[model samples]
Target: MADETDEPDSAAHPFTRLTPDLVMDATESVGFQCDARILELNSYENRVYQIGIEDDEPVIGKFYRPERWTESQILEEHTYTQLLADSDISAVPPLIIDGSTLHEFDGYRFSLSPRRGGRAPAVDDLNTLEVLGSHIGRIHAVAGDGGFTYRPLFGLQEFGLDARDAVVAAGYIPAELMPAFDSLYDGILADLAALFERVSVNTLRLHGDCHMGNVLWRDDLPHFVDFDDARSGPAIQDLWMMLSGEREQQQNQMMHILRGYRQFNHFNLAELQLIEGMRALRMIHHVAWIARRWDDPAFPRAFPFFDSERFWSEHLLSLKEQWARLSEPAIEIYD
Candidate 1:
C-alpha cells in the first residue's frame, strides 16, 4: 500500500523529471526555502526564477544536477564565495547550512542569490562598460593576498573536459579542421601545462566564473552571481575570462573591469599580459567542453562564436576580415 504522495518525485535529476512538489520538499525538509519559478534550462545549467518573487527573495535559484558537477566542484565554489563576501565584494554568496557549509540538496549544488534584478546591460552600452570594468578592477585589486587561494579548478586529468577530449580523440573535428585538431589540442595542452607550471602558484579567492553572463545591471550597478566555480587562483585569473572575449586595444570594457580591480589590487604590465593568456586558455577549454556537449539540445547554437557549421565558417571568415583588428596573441584562462 503506497500513498502516491509519499513517493519521491521522479523528475529530480538528469534523465529524470522534477516536479514542483519535489523542489518544495527539497527546500522545506532540507534547510531553507527559495520560491523559484522554473524559467529555462540550458546545456549544462538550470536557471530558475528570480526578481523578488515569493516574499522578497532577491535572486534566482540555480540547482545544478550532479551529472554536471561533483561535490568537490561545489566545495571549491563555496571557498571563493566566502572570499568575495569576506572581502566586501559584490559576488553571489551561497546561503549557509547550520551557520556554516553551504546548503546543498537533491543530489545537486544550489545557490540562491540576487538575480541581476533586471535586463543585463550590454558590453556595448555606454556607461555599462565603464561600470563593469570598474567593478571588475575592484575585484581584481584584491589580488593574491586578500582572502583567496590557488587550488586548480581544472586538473590535467579531470579538466571537466574529458568528454570533449573523447570526441577529438575519436577524430570528431569538423571536416575543414581535421588536420588542425591534433596540433591544436597538443599545443593547447602543452601551453596550459607550461603556463600552469611557471606561474608562481599562490592563493587568492575569486569569483571562479567571471564573464559578461555572470554580471548584470541591478540598480544601475553591476550585480554578479554564479560563484559556483569560485576557488583559489591568481586573482588576475578571474578577470582574464572576461578580457579574452575582446582584445586589449579595444578593451575599454575590459579596462573598466581592470580599473575596477586596480582600485583594490595592482599588477605589472607583464603580469596583466600573462593573466590575459590565462583568460584565452579558459576560453579554449570551455569551447572544447561545449563542442562535446553538442549532443545536448540546450547547448548554445554554436558557442564561443556561432551555432552551425555554416555560421562557424562565416565566423572564421569574419575573423580573417578582422585579422588586422586583432592586435594581441593569446595564452590560456580557464578549461
Candidate 2:
C-alpha cells in the first residue's frame, strides 16, 4: 500500500498521476521491458527519465506536460527531428513504435529515445562556436523549407507581450518594486517593438531554445537536442543565445559563427540588428515561464530565489540594462 503522502495530489499538479509504478507500466505498455531502474532527468517543463531496460541499454522517456502542447504540435516537433536525422544531422529523434513517434499511456503522452551522452559545448571557444553555428546553419537550411502549420510563431505577442501579461496576472512582481518594474518592462517592450519594426527578417522554423545546455559536444562535434520549443522565428533567435561577454567579444564570436553559418545557408546581415531585441524578449519570457510554472513542486525547489524581493529587484535592474542595450546599435561583426 502506498502512503497517502506518497501519492501526488492531482488537483495540485498534472504529474501527480505519474508515480513510479505508472512510469514502469507505461514503458512496458509500449513494449519495452523495464529493469525497474528509473532515474529522473533534469527537466522542468516535461517529466523525463532514464529507465533501464530488462536486457538492453537504458532508454530515455519524456512525458509531455498535460495541455501544454496539442498532439499535432508535439508530432510536428517529432517529425522535424526525424527530418533532421534523415538529413544526416546529429539530432536525436523519438523512437517510432507502431508508425507513431508519440504514444499515450494512462492518459499521459510520452516518447522514448536512446540515451545520448556528452558534455555542454564550449561556448567561449570560438572554434566550438563556429562548429555550433554550422550545425545551426544546416538546421536552418532544412527549416527554410517552409513554415510550420501547427506550431506557434516566435514574436513579441508570444514571447514579450503575452509573458508580461501573464507575469502581471500572476502577481509575481514584488509590491514595492511593481512601480519600477512596470515602467521598465513597458519601456523595454516598446523599444523592442520599435526595433523589430526596423528590421526586415524572414521567419523560419528554428531550434527555438538553442542554448549551451541544449547542445552536447562530443569529439569536437555538436548534437542538438530538445526541439520541444521549436517554432518559426528569426534566424537570429537561434544565434544570439550562444554569445556572451562584452560587445567586442560578441562581435568577434559572431564573425566566427557566421563564417560557418554562411556555408550552408544565406547569412542575412540585416537580421544582425534584431539580436538585442531577441535577447530582451527572451529575458521577459523566461521570467514569465518560471512564474507560470511556480506551482510545480520542482520549480520552488530548483528556483528558491524566484519571487523574493532581492530576486525581483535584481531582475528589474537587469531589465533596465537590457533596455539600455536595446537603444544601442545591434552588434556589428567586421572582417
Best by TM-score: 2
What C-alpha lDDT values do all the predictions have?
Answer: 0.52, 0.88
True lDDT of residue 289, candidate 1? 62
Candidate 1 TM-score over all chains jointly? 0.67
TM-score for each model: 0.67, 0.95
Cα lDDT tens digits, model 2, 1-335, are: 11213322336898878998999999999899999999999999999999999889999999999999999999999999999999999889999988988999989999999999999998989998899989999999987845798999889898999999988887767778888988898888888888788888888888899988899888889999999999987898899888899999999999999988988998779889888888888889988998788778888788877767788889888878888887787788664
Q: Count the backbone clashes (under 3 Å) in each candidate.
A: 36, 0
Candidate 2 ranges beyond 4 A from true positions: 1-11
Which digits, one per residue and each the tens of the lDDT, describe model 1 over residues 1-335? 11212322334425244455555555555444556554543326453533234565544556665455565666666665566668886776666656644455665455655454545667666466657667766665543554423344434344523633654553334567544544545555565566556555444666767766777677778777766566555555665555435454335445565555555556443345455345444545555565545444345433523333554345334433333232355432221
